[model samples]
Target: MKSLIQIFLVSALLTTCINVNAMTASPQSWWVGMQTNSLQIMLHKQNVAKHQWQLMPYSGVNLHNIIKTDNPNYAFLNLEISPSAKPGTLVFNSAAGGRFEYSLNARKANSSKRRGFDSSDTLYLINPDRFANGDSTNDSVKGMLEAANPIERGGRHGGDIQGVIDALPYLQKLGVTQLWLTPPLENNMPSYSYHGYAITDFYKIDSRMGSNALYRELAAKAKQHGIGLVMDLVLNHFGSEHVWMKDKPTADWINFNGDFANGKHATSHARQTIQDPHASDFDKRQFSDGWFVATMPDLNQRQPLLANYLIQNAIWWIEYADLSGIRVDTYSYSDKAFLANWTKAIMTEYPQFNIVGEEWTSNPAIASYWQAGKVNNDGYTSSLPSVMDFSLQESLIQALNEDESWNTGWVKVYQSIANDFLYPNPDNLLVFADNHDMSRVYTQLKQDLAKTKMAMTLLLTTRGIAQMYYGTEVLLDNTGSNDHGDIRIDFPGGFKGQKSNAFTGQGLTIDQRDMLQTISTLLNFRKQSAALSQGKLTHFSPKDGVYSYARTSEKQTVLVFLNKHAEMKSWPLHYMEEVLGSQIHATELFTQQTVNLNKAVTLPAMSAVVLVIE
Candidate 1:
């Protein structure tokens, strides 16, 4: 409504008052010598698109194009950095007086050749908010919508990255080679943000948890102790509190026109739609583009700009934090084409890096479809390296809880592993007894210590990469409730007012101490066994209440027996002659005593027997 002269003067004043540091830039920094020569920087400021951007004279660096979106506050600078470019500050000046300096830093030596987690590693999943609280000062961070409320089940409990850093020694001693923490990114929701699934900011860590620098520090410290870090990422949806929910970059930045009807736009969770040949377009849309919950807005990755942003963000975290792996939450919920491009970009950058997606289906056919090397009828090629073995997890729990029958008990486990042929690389799958989203294995087995032992032993000695919930070693239980907060209980001695200390083995119940020893023994042994980690598996059909298998490497062979009987059973060796290979003697892993393999081996009731034949 103002006159031309008045508006001109106001615009001039705003440009003169512009603070380059105050304006935000996605990938605020960059590095030279990346695998890709193309880089896109999204600049966000008041009327940022109004000014034409120019790059100061720098060798081998050129501003190829500037993309101005529908939003006047956003500008995308497409840059091409040739190999001749050196590491330095890039000065970007606007037509007016506004200027911004972006760093083009040097990459770490051989950064692209970094190795990721594999079958040799044991992943321990920790819900950081419930793990430990090393710094109480940031318990109630200012400006965060939800404050610390330890008494409330769903409220934040103040566990920060520093706590994880402090526990590296303990975790290293426990023989876990990899740590998979739930999303530690910013989740500025009104409540129940402690679980860290609904991320508000993709680039920054939650202030209540810790700063981005502290997260990098934890990764470095973990690496020093022969441990790797696996970051959990949510790609399908984000917290509604994210800035895109208000000032969107594009008209279709969020799916379904950014509208969340009361349970109307919710996802059908029909994961099979992605592979079902008979799926209708309506069903596919309902499963893929629909919102997860009212508080979470599904992202429209089909938009090329947003797709580039997400792909770049993931690579940025890997480079910035030196992460060893990534675990994608709700893997199949995003646009399949975008997921393919996203993973292909990452794997192209770091060919050896590992990424495991959470398909969360008991059907091996559906879960295996997402893994790399899968040949699908629809010609959908995935670059994902691994998928969680939910089939084995569900089968293991049911096997222990059910009575021995022709189709029950040990047969369930045998049948579960029998389905491994469906996987392109079964050894790459992640096997776990329980995770943050479900009841603890101890509770699922009705607090039967023997069955828990059997389950842990089988997981540790079986095929695929093994992951255990944080407090599984201590038998953390949430028997009566299916609440998420209860499933992800705080570790013993992590917070104040805890009677038992799992770290120090003080004041723990005898059963807890025993279970801890069982887990520690298996983990330590597995660390040295090439046979157990990545090996050829041979199994016999389930006979009576026993299921047996052998994992054989070039140098060592590991024999495992899971007996669900009520009394000790003598398992014959003739059934496994091909796997045993005329070995006369073997050492029991638990007792460390040599036994003659010419006859039958004794397996205790409701227990596992793991032996090494070298």
Candidate 2:
């Protein structure tokens, strides 16, 4: 017993001495620390005697001045972890008698899954202020323009980023793959800038909408749920009340500061002169320097410092938010040279990033000039990857509104696309039936549900990225006028005490639910269909009121027919025989019914059919 007690005492003393020596010998030169709501870290020490790692308690370890320590230590690190650690780990070696080594292994505590956006995404474009207002706390900000009034169409209704973040599941159920909120940058104009066009600060998110950190969290949360966030950016102008405007950075900080040039009427013929080498500088300045409104001052991209600042601001947002894509507003108004450089820099950092520019020209030639890869007559180069298909929107509107005529009427869309040769790559174009600037698609089609469905079918099956304006699923309308304020009315259920709520699908007429379901089904179907994305497009326009197209890929083929005849008509097989290529089987995508392509398929008046060839 005495001998055993002596051995135990000696062993304890040796262990204590060794531990003290190990801690003192190589006073840790480096340490790791982490603090994030989204992740956590765990530390483990290697036990060579046990031939395994033993978990170390680093919950409250201090990591300041880590690099000032003496010994070198190796540690394994994990990212996007969870379960929370107060500090982290530090490891060192003992050199009391002989050299001893210690190392650390950092394993992720809990990791969330990763997701990516894809081509089948049905983008929902929302002006957040007009969407929903879940929180009324931040309605009135300090020192900002405009008061929050839910009843007023043009006033800030307190619809914020948090509101949208709260409604993600509602959108997810509606089969929305992406969300495109309008510009949320601070717009500090005294009044009527609630739409966020007049940016006061590029770096700060509009306080009414949310904080920068909140926006980043929104993006991270949206990504976790398999949703893509598209940021709306503006490079053309800043709010006249912008702080920099009060104290100009340089003589050329703003374009034509000596005399403010009011905006000129957008004429494609006149604007196309921008690409002409012989065009007078007066004409160029008129287009580039002119202000969109008295309250919005055109920015001078020619100023090198301002240009760099704008470019860096865009990159900073992308990096900070890990954004899926960008939508540049007023794409053509900026300097052509500056746009090329800006786009090149963004594309360099994010190779797969997507961007859609708003050219807002109905003429394909004028619009195509701004799209990337268009070889201009004057050797003008552009780096823009995509453009909003304004031509398609114009054609769709005219088709729905015009009376049937010999060479006009619904055939306008067929002819419009026939001139698609103007575009170098039409597939990259963003096709939308309506946006914030235009009359709602439902109103344009005279509130005809069938026609609205037909229009949406065309947009979804067409050979370009499709974007749906918010409230299209529920057939939201602007009543009659196309005034800006009237066009961006408040969304149902966006505010407290609202009689209707789009999020809950309450107070909606049966017709509204039917339209919403139609959109939901088609969008979900589109999520799985590659033909709508990667397929080759072949279209035919044989008559004034009839149009058809086929999208074929390696695995599938889809046929779409649009008939705007006042009466039902049977479409002959020969019209689409070239694309059918001896079709074996066909099924309607919307109705899920087998279709007989060999027989003349009768279509209802002003109706469309999307048939999937099996």
Candidate 3:
């Protein structure tokens, strides 16, 4: 009888341990004083809905309700945390005798008022997997689907948060004020996961990249170097292998009943349909509801529970990581209504925070509709503060590669910038020469060093936030193909057996060294130039292959001239008299030569000239 009793007790204890271990929460914890009082926590486990839950009495905390879904594995708890609630733990018990603890932590001082990246900041976009490998031990973590294969372009290269932390001083010296790393969230896909678009777990960082604590440490160390961190977030879709895919909370958790139908439900990429007044309902649905690929399942943000989960998840990360900004990938592919709510919630909590959305369109009309304060004719409003300047990006490429003409060349760039009026706040736009999705600027310019210099000069001197792809300063190029893997090539000296070291400036050709120096000079100068950072822009029409513009402010005036001629030209400055006023002499930014602005300025062949008048 005693032996049988011991066996029964051991079985009961094993069952209890399994139950406790299986239980999980989306946001495992909360803060004491947020802007909002109500919080919804999603709990997941085996047969979680079958058990009745009761919260242990805690001061100023009330269990408003428990919502059970169609699936027995999921339960949602709606709680009201009052302002007077203090930081403590709340214990909950189920009728089946299962218990779990949730924590309510105190908020950091002035957490909600943290400043975000702005036009004055230059963002350096890094592919963490290709930047450097500081912790090779975590490179091929056990149980991870993919391992480090540095030789394979598409395979993981083992770069982690520590690598970025190691290179903070190099980035600071490179004149980068902000670092925009590609989505470092967990991507457990079998292949092609290095890009980080297909996120499997939203709350957890990829072990191959680093832990959540290490990510926060990167943010802290970056701050010490005067660089803010910008997290790249994917809201449109997630990896098909996400846990929710196997056990959905709601029937509509994944779009199309979680069925791809073998490309039958692929997105039409009709982004303009969002703003098109006459777009068909079928087209709108196909564009917004369709999946990017079979491996990437489109999320149904219309589901209230999922919506709440995503919003709270974003807020939780912002608080946890002390982030400075967020870059939303494939911004318009998500449900339009949910997008409005999502952006509004984030902005409400952090009024000074900035979020840039990638609309990926050259038409400012469509992109402008998503910016906050846009007065849409269809009565739609967005809380998005910034949009990528794709029009200028395309036009700048054309302006550099094509010959000057009445309807071509520099005119394209001029017309592109002229459309800035459509934007509510043009200065908030993100200007970049090349991003990870496209060919490097040097390759696009056909390895023309002079033209590449002109492109960088215009991007940095323009009236917007600037972002440079990693290794652009060293003229990293993909000459043969535009493969994404090639575009995101590994940085020199980040891994073993590389002859060049960008950090130490070893094995770099003369041209590479010059390009690095030129970009460094322009970026550092931009940091100190009020006229370039946030000022009024007055531009002259393309004349004799020269595109001239002047950025003026209360402190000083900056004149920029992009001369495409093969020989030095004396460009007349009479057209800029209104902005120049009584200033006669100016200092050249690059050569530091004093120039007389009374008549004309001498511009170098196929080069950019920036002159400052005080």
lDDT of 2 by residue, 339-363 (tens): 9988887665556677789887888
Q: For candidate 1, what's the RMSD?
A: 4.9
The better-scoring model by TM-score among 1 and 2 is 1
Q: Write the per-residue lDDT of candidate 3 for residues 345-386, one digit (tens) a residue.
A: 999999999999999999989889999999999999899889
**In candidate 3, how many Å is residue 37 off?**
1.2
Any runs in candidate 1 off by more than 4 Å, and if so which?
Answer: 1-18
Model-by-model lDDT, in order?
A: 0.90, 0.71, 0.90
Per-model TM-score versus the true fold: 0.96, 0.79, 0.96
Count: clashes, candidate 3: 0
Candidate 2 error regions (>4 Å): 1-119, 258-270, 542-544
Evaluated at residue 421, the lDDT of candidate 2 is 91
Query: In terms of lDDT, which candidate is stronger, 1 or 2?
Result: 1
